[model samples]
Target: MPLKELAERRAILHRKSDPQTIVKHALDDVQLGKVAMVSSFGAESVVLLHMISQTAPDTPILFIDTEMLFPETLQYQKDVAEELGLTNVQVVKPSREKLLEQDVDGILHTIDPDACCALRKTQPLEDALEGYDAWITGRKRYQSGSRAELPVYEKSGRKIKINPLADWNAAKLVAYIEEHNLPKHPLVARGFQSLGCAPCTTKTKPGEDPRAGRWRGQDKSECGIHIVDGKVVRQRNAA
Candidate 1:
């Protein structure tokens, strides 16, 4: 039941399994206890979503609508769920009271992106994951940064975080999507490789890292939602 022990055990058991098999195990393993899939429904999201749909259509899928997300992303989330027939896609968002108290005017991201992420994303997700013992993520090594050496299974706080596609590369994901005819995020067509909140996300140029567009020109790469290898990075508002 310990995070490390559980993660190591599951990793060893599924060392040779593919992403889909790992997904099935995550959803069906009773030890995981009410596992849920957290998706951004951004570019490259449909692959894992499609996998979950096939493995367990009723699995709870958490989609954090930072509310500052692009209009295209908003619609894409709805379209992907309906297209996949995912039965339990829960829309998570920062509470109105928290928003009013910390990010009134919705411009906190302009001044302090870290605190903004904490209020909008990390805090809300932590609240949403209250009863779940494990959660699935769509992270892949090919995306680079701290994620470059990501493991298939890792311990996040008290929860077991499973990265089914940790080893998958962009080419492999493209091939899989094309082979399965999975739908892509609408912004992908306009060169947005990694999708996040609309204001913080930008278009990734050719030959740049897929996530180069996120928090562009800033020192931040992750939204604190994934600051999880060992440190729990949450920026609190001065207020």
Candidate 2:
């Protein structure tokens, strides 16, 4: 099936459904039998992860560990998986040899963030997802920038990208987390609204976009993972 048609058909089928229902439909895809969920396991990650744990506990969950990530994030990833009984958590990382060659000093993020992300995140994820035909993500439209127009379903290459939470907002996220008593990323209470690699993420101030804390001073918003169809779409920085 074509990616566009697949996304459209699924979107129509789940038009009136909730985010969890959208997730369930993606998990049940016959053509894309081996779907994976890519999660950051950051501040707002628990919602989708918790949904996946109930909908498909065995589904592979990809967690890209940029060597630059916060220690809290690493521990949060482990704790979340254990707490949810997620059995197929796959840890993806840039190869040691490549890191030694391209970013030996670990300062690539300072000179070229795009290269840094491609080296640590994009390429590693692309390599890890070689055999999968579809993947689920935790993006929401309210996150801003190009994501402000995010769709519930979209096709990327031969795979269908499902954004089950595309319509959710901060209020919904907060309510869901509190209602479920989900654990938060340790940095949230410390004023870090968005959690990414420690070196890139910073503290968000009052009335700022939730993601303002990510890549604080840079012109970048995303870490190069949220490509739109075939084009590399850069998100807006600073709400």
Model 1 TM-score, 2 decimals: 0.95
Encode model 1's per-residue lDDT on 139-174: one tens digit a residue: 998786667677888888888999999998999999
Q: If scored against the real structure, what TM-score would every candidate get?
A: 0.95, 0.96
Report the poorest 10 consecutive residues by lDDT, candidate 2: 230-239
Tens-digit lDDT track of model 2 for 1-239 = 77798788887777778999888878987865689999999989999999999898999999999988999999999999999999999999999999999999999999999999999999899999898988999999887666877778888866789999998999999999999999999888999888888888889888888888887777788887878765677756845
Q: Poorest 10 consecutive residues of model 1 by lDDT? A: 230-239
For model 2, the superposed segments whose C-alpha errors exceed 4 Å read: none
